[model samples]
Target: MRTLFSKCLVAPALFASTLASAEVKLPFTLDWKFEGPSAPYFLAVDNGHFADQDLSVEISAGQGSLDAIPKVATGAYPVGFADINSLVKFLDQNPGAPVTAVMMIYDKPPFAVVGRKSQGISTVADLEGSVLGAPPPDGAWAQFPVFAKENGLDMSKIKVEPVGFPTREPMLAEGKVDSVTGFSFSSYLNLVRLGVPEEDLTTLLMADYGLALYGNAIIVNTDYAEKNPEVITGFLTAVAEGVKDAAADPMAGAQAVIDRNPAGNVELEAWRLKLALQDSILTDYVMANGLGDIDVERFEKALEQIAVTYEFKGEPSVSTIFTDAYLPASELLMMK
Candidate 1:
């Protein structure tokens, strides 16, 4: 009886060891704080999507869209979410930073110049002589020049104020600045939280004005991706599932985010998640081509648009910056 019991214990221990070895530890970095858009990922965690792919993913909040680019480039984290345009410039400066976008989110690109309707910023032309608060590292600010140029606004006429991310909205609410550069979903909701009426906000979406730009994407360290292609694929697969789940039931996704961030307002964050889904994530192209893919032709035009504002050290190739080789099947990626 003692020998039989010992044998059972050995089998269970080995099984435990196998489970531990089989699970790949992957830490994911996000572009911003825990908010509505982040819900899908939390839902993925709650639903065991990562575990289904034999991955143990840990998602951490970020400071801004540009924050996670270097984290992944340095191999400090294997995968990260960041602005793809920022990645383009980083690659241009670093020459070979080992970071490239694998999955495209924010298909419509949330970069926008948000102004208060009551502050004489109802039109893009209104920014010509108004105070514009801009965060230096903000993804929207990074693309503001393009937005300005496309809209035929003289940037020289626009009075720019450099502000911290935390103060960007507050300053606007207090009438410190007439306008601000930020993501549409983020800035719009932020002002709402600051007691600004929804009707008083004027969101000048860059994409609507003629900037053919892509937004944030899942970026990976090339070295890490090369060594662990399967892991990258699994991570993306799990993320796609998360996005789908979020789209299906945004409220549930918001609940997932609220679970991790108790301070967040569930109703507001749910609406925010819904805003991201409708305005940025689930676009006509995304819905038609399925998620985790991009139109090469449109991407090329976007690269050309970026080149207008940014000088590239080495020639940038669309294929080099992004790849769909690791994407799951269309059925798995289709959000609909």
Candidate 2:
């Protein structure tokens, strides 16, 4: 990881002779498990992408993407990554949580329905009236019904079966459910790794069906961004660079993550991550535009729907739900 950034840096002696540097501290509340898809965030730290912009960051795990929003709003973390749905809920429930979005991370939402070709199921339409598998607690299938209406899907027609977590891959192979709902980056790729031929499987993207909403995002407290705008901007700039690097070379990023772990399945995690990058939408969507990028207009559409679902009681617009000052970096990183 150090080697990568060093390749891009100007010679130290010349840079030192000409420039001035300042140190800044920042805290990040991670949106996923350590060394998973969030590996790029670790890459950003290990490779000094944060340091290049005079920002230093401390990263800690978050239970779910949704959980990060409240933590950032409360100042437990100056900035964090989260899903679009939860942040909207937080704003409606608390009315005082000052969270806002930084950038849109996954251009194509990661939601998908997977089925084995051998099972004779090959499309989202096939799941109509068919049994569908879901990860019990946070399974994408359970998230399906609430998000389904937006996609023009008839969620009531489908039978949802609660499947154990981390078992979707094999269960699909064994014909447990006709299809399973999950993120392509995590669960689906696990199936591919276990020798499920891509040609023998069908993946139907939920986003194509109108379930299009931002999945991962970088978030910060609106108050902190208002006061220390530059620091937030620099922090996101570094994070974006890290996202870019991860896309260009996931192996390096995965290795960087593996290098950080002290014990327990380092190699297994690394291999799985590499497979995830190869088959996941993460690289194709997020790589080109940079990471943590959010579209307000797109977000507003989903936010309105969720607020109505949760009975926000007609509170307010989602425009104030997030801030982009940090991730866009339209100013500071470009300025002298």
lDDT at residue 80 of model 1 (Cα atoms): 91
State every prediction's TM-score relative to the real structure: 0.91, 0.80
RMSD of each: 2.4, 7.4
Q: Where does candidate 1 clash, by residue pair?
A: none
What TM-score would candidate 2 get against the native? 0.80
Residue 14 of model 2: what lDDT?
Answer: 61
Off by over 4 Å in 2: 1-22, 146-153, 193-195, 262-293, 304-309, 328-336
| Candidate 1 lDDT score relative to the true structure | 0.89
Q: Which ten residues in a row have the lowest lDDT in candidate 2?
A: 327-336
Tens-digit lDDT track of model 2 for 1-336? 468668557577567754544566788888766765677778888888887877778888778866787788888888888876667666777777678777655566566777776776776666777877887666355357655666556878888887877776777766777778787656656687778787877777666666545566678878888899888877777766776677676667777766666452555565656545444435444444434555567667666555534677446565666555455544422211
lDDT by residue (tens digit), candidate 1, 105-132 = 8798988899998999999889998999
lDDT of 1 at 152: 96
lDDT over C-alpha atoms for residue 119 of model 2: 72
lDDT of candidate model 2 versus the reference: 0.68
Clashes in predicted model 2: 10
